[model samples]
Target: MPQQELFNNIYQTHYDKVHRLCKGYFNGHEGMAADATQEIFLKVWQHLDGFRGEAKLSTWLYRIAVNTCLLQLRKPATTKEIKTEQLPDVVAEEYNPVTDERLKKMYGCIQQLDETGKMIILMVLEGVEYSAIAEVVGSTEETLRVRIHRIKKQLSTCVQL
Candidate 1:
């Protein structure tokens, strides 16, 4: 396959997953998540030629996504004020206050976690296999299992409060 076609194929295949992963990192801020997702694909395009196929392509893409999100978070913000009025209004068919409140609390808890913990738990919530997450996180599956258990326990306690 030509390089452009290969890059296009990989982007189409993994974009949504990468976007959602970015969303998790951004505390559900869709705009920030989208920006991060675009930056991740740019990095993918730059580094695709170096891919050695030692790991699954999805895993490589995910590693890029995670690193991109981390880099974005670490950058200092230039704009202090958010112009929410410029954003398009989102209409929902049905609204449940209870569920919304619970989700808010859950995200709040997630935001409080350490960076790596947040990444690990988000991947776990997304149902990424332990082996894959371990690979992406540079840890053994057994260690990830234990860490995930602790993260879940911490989140449960936080949400219940």
Candidate 2:
């Protein structure tokens, strides 16, 4: 397939999830996520021709997204400063596992965690599997399970009060 078509396919397939992933990383800072998402796709477009088929496409896209988010976090203002000019005109919305009702509080609580804990729980919130999260975060599956359990309890308590 041509590079443009391949990129278009990948973007269409991954955009919503990728955008959500970036949004989560930015603590619901939609503008920052929007910028990072664009940068991620640009990188994907530039590099798609060399994809080796060794990893799942989603995995590859996520790797790019996580890296992009991490890079964005390293910048001066941080995700907190890059707020959206306006909120979405939501008539109403329900929070699912992915869109946790407590997401803002959760993210705030997550900010208080150590880097490793934050990574673990962030992946869990994103609904990434324990095994994949372990691979990405460089921990054992058992270790992640323990960490996630603790993290969830901690966030729940924090959110409740």
Candidate 3:
């Protein structure tokens, strides 16, 4: 396949998920997420020639997107919290109220997590399989299972508090 076709396939497949992930990392900064998403695609375009397929393509794209967002985060100017309500109102009629509320609460709790904890939970929340999460996080499935259990218990208690 041509590089453009490959890039288009990846972009179409992962854009929404990657955008949400970027939004989480940016704490709902739509502008930042948009910028990061573009940069991620750029990186993917540049690096596509060298992709040897050692890992799943989604994993590789996520690795790039995460790193890109983190790098943007390293800049002091990018650290301010943008109010989600103040964001440009796009077509959100499709957003389910209950799911949005849950996601907001979940992200609120997630903000308290340390980086590694946040990454693990984000992958899990994104519906990445436990086994795939283990690969992304570099731990055994057994260890991940225990950690996820503890994390959920902690969230349950914290939410109730």
Local lDDT at 105 for model 1: 85
User: How do these models rank on TM-score, best leading?
Assistant: 1, 3, 2
Better of 1 and 3 by lDDT: 1
Model 3: per-residue Cα lDDT over 4-94, one tens digit each: 9989999998898888888878766678889999999999999999999998888788778777877887887835565455533365867
Report the backbone clash tally of model 3: 0
Clashing pairs in 2: none
Between candidates 2 and 3, the one scoring higher on TM-score is 3
TM-score, cand. 1? 0.91
Q: Best by lDDT, which number? A: 1
How good is model 2 by TM-score? 0.76
Measured with C-alpha atoms, the lDDT of residue 34 in candidate 1 is 95
Each model's lDDT comes to 0.87, 0.77, 0.79
- What shift in Å separates residue 115 of candidate 2 from its native position after superposition? 3.7
lDDT per residue for candidate 1 within 34-98, as digits (tens), equals 99999999999999999999998888888888889999999999889555643322546786768
Task: List the lowest-lDDT window of 10 residues for candidate 3.
Answer: 80-89
